[model samples]
Target: MITAFLHGFLLALGLILPLGVQNVFIFNQGATQPRLIRAVPAVLTATLCDMLLILLAVLGVSLIVLQVVWLKTLLFGAGLVFLLYMGWSIWRSPAGVSQAERPEPFSPRKQIAFAASVSLLNPHAIMDTIGVIGTSSLQYDSPDKWVFTASCILVSFIWFVGLAVCGRLIGRFDGSGRWLLWINRLSAVIIWGVAAYMGWQLLASA
Candidate 1:
């Protein structure tokens, strides 16, 4: 049981630790409007979505997902577009814009919508949940699958909450405009990198 839990934890980390669209967006929100108090809702929504997908994967729906080549391709393409658009938006935003320039507080509905969009529209999330995580779960014993799924869900919740809270803490430092600028830049780069990798995979599979 201990070994199973450790394996599950590592697998979950492997899926979630990458700098994907969701992570980048969360980080941006943290840096830009850390005080909005909506970050918790956003993170919680994302974690819940992740748990749902993981559940689907564990139930063997992932096999169906893998068979739909065109659907996967379309999702990947959409993700690429989203990443590029976000990257452009971040790059074009004023580097020194103060928190005063930030938008009004995000409502609960808006936070949930943002989280759902990030998860649903991201091809990598699908692949990670439906392909990688699903495949890993199959390697475990039947009794251990539940343990694995639980660990993955826990990891999602912990990571997102920790990231959101840490971002708020970091954003509290005054005169950190340059640091924020670099984070935006880094987020943009990570988005592009993931897109490029996905494109390469799509081409390679063709």
Candidate 2:
């Protein structure tokens, strides 16, 4: 159980350390929001989505889903399209929040929806959970498997909340629009970057 817990925690931490679209979005939101609490919805939503995926993967549902070639292909295509759209939207968002003309904070609904898209739609994230975490679980006994699953899920929450907290701290010095504007630009890049990678994989597999 100890070994399984350590393996799951370390592997999950590694897979999630990338500056991927989901992480970028969560960070940007935390930086942009007027209050730290405003960023909570996005953080929780993203964490929950990942938790669900990890759970499903550990339970072997991911393997079952992967058996459907056409369905997986269709999902990949849709995810790519969604990523493009999301990237464009972020790029077009207001550059900064000034006292005179503050940009509206993302509502709870919008935050959850976008977070879900970034978390659930990205083929890279899905595959990592399914491939790394799911495959690792196969080597564990029932007790160790549960411990591994719990530890992996725990890491997701820790990482997401930590990111939001870091962003909140950065927001203090970046009161100007410049920092946030650049963040949006970078966030857009991250989103499109993942989209491009997935697109290439799909093409290569074709």
Candidate 3:
């Protein structure tokens, strides 16, 4: 049981530790929002999406879903387009604007929507969940399997909350928002890089 728990915890952490679009958006929200509570929608939505994906992956459902060629192509195409748009949006968002001129932060509804998009639309993230976590879960059985699944889910929840909290702390110190502007630009670049890679993969598969 201990081994299973550790395996799941480490595997999930390893997968999530990378600076992916989901993490970037969550951290951005935590920093830009007026208060941490305002970022809860994004945090909760992302965590729930991860939980759903992890559960589906461990249960073998996502593997079956990815087996469909056309469906997989469609996922890749949609992911590419959405990521490109999201990158542009983040890049253009008013981060370093003066306080009087700065636009309002993302509303709760917008936060949830964007969180879901980044979480669910990215085929690369889905494939990673299925390929890594799904295959890893096969090594366990019954109660151990459930234990492993729980451990993975727990890691995601804690990691996202911690990420947001850390972002909030950094935002508190950066009163002028100059740091936020750079962070947004960096996040956009990273997101576009991922999108380009996915597009290349989609073309290669054609």
78-194 per-residue lDDT for model 1 (tens digits): 766766776666666566656554433346676677677778767668767877788888878767888888998999998887787767666667353666777777877887787
Give, for candidate 3, the lowest lDDT window spanning 10 residues.
Answer: 95-104
lDDT per model, in order? 0.74, 0.87, 0.88
- For each of the candidates, the C-alpha root-mean-square deviation to the true structure, in angstroms, is 2.9, 1.5, 1.3
102-141: candidate 2 lDDT, tens digit per residue: 3446788889989999898887788888989999899988
State the lDDT of candidate 3 residue by residue for 56-171, as single tens digits.
Answer: 99989988988999999998898899999988988898765565433247889988988998999888789899999999999999999999999998998898888889878877
Each prediction's number of clashing residue pairs: 0, 0, 0
Ranking by lDDT: 3, 2, 1
Greater TM-score among 1 and 2 belongs to 2
- Native-to-model Cα distance after best TM-score fit, residue 187 in candidate 1, in Å: 1.2
Instruction: Look at candidate 3 and give me any clashing residue pairs.
Output: none
RMSD in Å for candidate 2, one decimal?
1.5
Error in Å for residue 90 of model 1: 2.6
lDDT score, candidate 2, position 58 = 95
Better of 2 and 3 by lDDT: 3
